[model samples]
Each structure stands twice: as structure tokens, then as C-alpha cells.
Target: MSVIIKAAPLELMIIGGAALGAYIIANPMKVIKAGFKMSIKAMTAKGPQKQDYVELLQMMFQLFQAFRKEGPQGIEKHIEEPDKSDIFKAYPSFMHNHHAVHFLCDTMKITLSAEMSPYDVDDLLDADIKAIHHEEHMAVHAVQTVADGFPGLGIVAAVLGIVKTMAHLTDGVEKIGALVASALVGTMLGVFGAYGLIGPTATKMGADIDAEGRYLGCIKAAMVALQRGAPPIVCVEYARRSIMPEERPSFEEVDKATKEIKKAA
Candidate 1:
């Protein structure tokens, strides 16, 4: 590794510098920051875990129950200021997610007002979900753009290496061979960086973003079901079914959970 670096130091600088400059030019500060955060999250998190999905369903069930038992007026306090509400506070993980919280509260606000049709509410939620993810998609796209440029940048590094070698034709055969080897390392680095590192990271980021959107989609499913006057159990089932199969709670599990919630209430 050190030998490769020593041989290709100039190649490294040119490729690395050009890539960084392009990334900086291509993305705004917000996108650059989002890219960094998304990469970190993709590395650390496996998207929404099974337990996370279960907890989300549980929270929605409780909220719907509150609305059913006490009427819209009774549930008003919880949605109006979720931070202060005991129901939301109980699920610390869900509370920490600002998008989920706002999505729940905003939709509930509209529902309590009794203004929109259930289908209209569904459409509104779909639009909101798309709008929220659009920025995240841009961040992933920026990283993919960088990955796509890497192989070409590697060629650029190799060409520069050859240019430098050309200026040293008077050197011995041993020196010329070393220069050629260094040039080849630049190409290797570029291709390897693209396929092995940045490309894979971008793909992972895209998956994570999709997983997050699906989590929100579950909330939308439940909220729309509620608007349609489904019972709390059916509302939660709508949400539960929206979850990916692996992460989804079983029907018996959801049934048992709602029962426990009722017992507690």
C-alpha cells in the first residue's frame, strides 16, 4: 500500500483533488451535509428494524384508541402538542424521528378538523411522502454521480502518470518501469474506489432512504384507514401490512399488542 502511494502520489492528488472539486461544485451545502449524514446512517443502521416497526404500530394503535374512546376533542391534546403528550413520549424512538412525528400530527390535525375525504387524505399523504424523500433522493444521486465519474477519473490519473513518464525518457529502463507501474496503480485505484467503495455506499444509502420512506408509508396507511372509520385494530393492521414482510408483525402479535394496550388503558 505504501509502495503504491509512493509511486502514485501525484496521480492520487490529481484524481482525489478533481473528485472533491466536482463533488463540491455539484452539490449545495444542504445536499453535501445530507450525503454525509445518510452515509453514516447507512453504515450504522440496517434501516427500520423489526422492533422499530412493531413499536410504530403500537404507538399508532394507542393514538387511535385515544381518539375512539374520548372522541376527537379528547385526543386533541396529544396531537396538538405531541412533545408534551405522554402517549408520544412513551415511544422515545418514534418521538426522536421528527418526520414521523410531524406526519402523524399533521395528518391527525386535518382529520380532527373533519375537512377532507379519506381518499383525499390518502393522496395528500402520498404527496407529502414523495416531497420528503425527494431531498434524500438527491443526496443519494449526488453520491452515485461521484461513483460514476471515478473510473473516468482513474483514466485521467493514468494519463497524467504517462505524461510525467514521457518527460523522463532519458531515465534508465528500471526507472521507466517504475513510472509505468505507478500509472497503472492510478487506474486500479479509480476503478476499485468506484466499484468497491463509493458505488456500494451509494446503493446502501438508497436502500436506507427507501426503508425510511416505507416506515412513513405505514403511518400513512394507518392514518388513511382511520379516516375511513376503520376500528383501531383494522387501522393498525393496515399499517402493519404496509411494513415489509420480514419486518411486519404477525396478525396474532398485533392482536395481542392491542389487547395489552386496552388492558393498560
Candidate 2:
């Protein structure tokens, strides 16, 4: 069947404009701006990828090897002086991210200082990461809510079209058909906004959240293994395998890297 191409930008403007006006009236510009910023971040900044996992393992292996060579005292110097640590300098992305930096360093520092049980420390720190991500979830909820309302809002747009059509009842059948068709476009816009834009955005945000969650889980796996006194090779493996398959490196890759560290030692 041939497609009927319809141009109804003005009609969409009427409906979408009214919806946006209402949102503006309900929310302050600052709150709206913040929401906008969050939306942009969600769209632009994806979660850590597979290479990030590989880098993390590489870093952990190096650090663990350092600890093995010079004992806790050597690792302590890095923790105490992260700015001076060549290890921290190696991964600019991890180093630049204050959250990631603090998460990694704080756990190891506590292990050194609190004399904490590695498993207990891992559990407590995992809880902390969950709480942090939970707070970020408000952004996800905001997007999903926008999606849910879009279809109904489109119906609202359609009603305005009908109201316009009713005003011109004396018009010919041709005019009425045009009016009805124009009105349905609002409904169409709503469904389109809901499914095509907002719904997909929500799904993407969820995936991003899951990816970040896996990153934190890697930290947990490594820290737990270290606490349990596993060798550096085994400890990094726990972290490496914690990664999702789409991003996980081969075992041989990790093993070869671990061997390189041993060789360097």
C-alpha cells in the first residue's frame, strides 16, 4: 500500500506547545533545567564499557603486584599519596572520575586501616554503591514518567482538534475530513512521543544503570578476593569475570597480562 504523507507541524505545535506550557507553569525554570541536564547526560554519557573492565583489571593486577613486592607499606604510600602514585596516573579516566577514584581508594584504605574483613567490607561497600545508584534513579523515573504521559497527552491534543472542528460545523464535508484528520495527528504524536522517544529513552537509561552497576560489582569482586587473601591473579580474575559478557575479556587475555606482571616482578 502507498503511504499517505501528511504535513501537520502546526497541529503538533498546538498540542505539544500546550503540553510544554503546562510543564513550564508547573515547574520552575531551574528544576526544568536540571531535568534537561540529566536527560542530556543520560543520552550522552554511556556506562563504563568492556575496555573499562580490562583497564580496571590491569590496574588491580599492577597494584596487587606492588603490594606483593613491597608489602602493605608500599601500597600504603600510594593510598596516602594517590597524587604521586604512578599507578593512579596510568588510568586517566578512573583517576579523573572522583566517584570511581574515591570508591577504589577508600575501600583499599579501609582494608589497610580498619583491618576490616574483606567479605564484610565488600558487603558494606556494595550497599553504599547501591545507595548511590538509587539516588541517581530519580532521573530514570522522571524520563519514564514523561513517556507514560505522552500518549494520553496526545489524546488531549486530539480533543483540542475536535473542539476546533466543532467550531466549523457549517463547513463542507471536505473541511470536516481535514479537521478530523488533523485532530488524529495529535493522538498520533502522543503515541509517537511515548513509544518512539520517551519509552526508548527509559530503556536506554536502564541499560546505562545496569552497566554502571556492573562496574561497581567489579570493584566488589576484586576487593573481596583481596580480603580473602587470594593471589593477585585470582583476585583480578574475580573482578574480570564480574564483567558482563559483552564487555568481558577472554581468560587467556587476563592470564597473559597477569603473567606479564609476574614477569615484571
Candidate 3:
């Protein structure tokens, strides 16, 4: 314990400093910023939850109903300035997700302003999803790369400890042993950091990224259905089906919620 206490700081400095330097070198400025931001988010951000999806589905249904009844002009005010739209403001959780808001609003704008078939809309939304996924995953990849290098960095720390131990061999058996033991702490820290901490963090970030992508995919499914002239309820059902089972609101739940929304309208 004493040896670890004495040696841990230097070992951590070496491993942490090298890892930070490597991360900076490997990633662009944008990705570096994003990686740090995402790492913080991974710890606190609960991706999209069941209630978030419920709000999202409800919002979409309302938007579709408006468009169906009154056409493009009806939705123009809402889509153009979503931050100020009463429909958007009503669903705070859905509106809070800036990426989701832009994705939905931007796609709707294009669909309304241009002559696009369902296939073209699908292609466009696919391209948007891919672009967002690629951007977010780059940060995840950067973090994973650092996690992978931690073990090797630990070995480096251990070797440095070994080198220090060699010089103290003449001091005494107790002193030499202490130095050797302290050096091993570096190895332990490295392995623990890689597997027990940093690696798992990277994995969490990746999972969150996938969850966000699925959220966007849900929007895509409904948007395509809307283009095909599906009714508002059917369009939202298409979206609800696209959600992962764990987070999907039940069909009855959604139906009841939409009925309530209609009553409010």
C-alpha cells in the first residue's frame, strides 16, 4: 500500500500525459473537442428514453395531421422556426434534442419545397443519418484508440520503474524490493484503466451513438411513410415500429396518447 501510494502519482502522470498527447495527435480539433464532450455526455446523458420516444411520436403525429388537413402551408410556420412553434414547444423533450429537431425540420422543408418521391426522401434521409453517424462515431473511435493504448502505456511505466529499481539495488534488500513493487503499480494501473475504466467508457459512448442513430432512423421511417400518403396515425406507427423494443411505446399507449392530442386540438 505504501509503495503504491508513493509510486501511483508518477505512474498516472506518465500514462495520462502520454494518452492525452496521443489523443490530440490522432484526432482533429473538432473530434478532440467532441471526444471530450462526448466522454462527459456518456457519463450523464441517458440517450433517448421511452418517454422521449413517446413525445417524439406524438409530435410527429400532430405535424402529419396538420400537413394532411391543410397541406405544406400549414406546416411551414412550425418547421421554419421550430423553437417558436407551439407544437414543438409542447413536447419539451423532443424539442430539446437539437439534432433530432434539425433532422426532422430540415427534411420536411426539402420534401415540401421540392418534388421528391418517397425513394428520393429515403435516400436523402439515409444520407443525413450516415453523415451524423460518421461524425459522432469519429469521437467514439478516438476514445477507443486511447483506451487500447493504455495497456501499452502501463508497460512503459512498469519498465521505467524497473530501470529506477536497478539503480537502488545497492541501497538494501528492503529498499530495492519497495522500488520494484512500486514499479509494478504502473502495470496494474494500465491494465485496470484499459479494461476496467477507459475501455468500458468507450464502449458506452458507442452504444449511445447507436441509440441516437436509431432515434433518427425512427424519424426517417415515419417521414417516408408520410411521403407515401399514409394517414397521420399510420405514419407515427411506422416510426414507433422502428424504435428498439426496450424503448418503444406500446401501440395502445401511442393510440391513446394521440387520441388525447386530438382532443386537445
Best by TM-score: 3
For residues 1-265, write the lDDT of model 1, one tens digit per residue: 7659795667768777898889989999999999988888878878778888878888999989888999988789999999999999988879988899999999999877768888999999999999989999999999999989988999999888899899888998988988888998889888988999889999999998788899999999998899899999899999998888988889888888788888999
lDDT, candidate 3, 198-230, per-residue tens: 888889999998999999999999999999989
- Candidate that scores best on lDDT: 3
Q: For each candidate, what TM-score against the reference?
A: 0.93, 0.81, 0.97
> Of the pair 1 and 2, which is ahead by TM-score?
1
Model 3 — which ten-residue stretch has the worst lDDT?
Answer: 175-184
Colliding pairs, model 3:
none
Residue pairs in steric clash, candidate 1?
none
What lDDT does the true structure give each of the candidates? 0.89, 0.76, 0.93
CA RMSD (A), model 2: 3.7
Task: List candidate 3 segments past 4 Å from native.
Answer: none
Better of 2 and 3 by TM-score: 3
lDDT of 2 by residue, 1-265 (tens): 0111352576567656765666566665654564566567677887787667777788889998888779889888777777788888886766765666777788888788777787688787888788767755665665676778778888887888899999889998988988888788878878988899767877787777677777878878888998998988889988988888888989988887667766766
Decreasing TM-score order of the candidates:
3, 1, 2
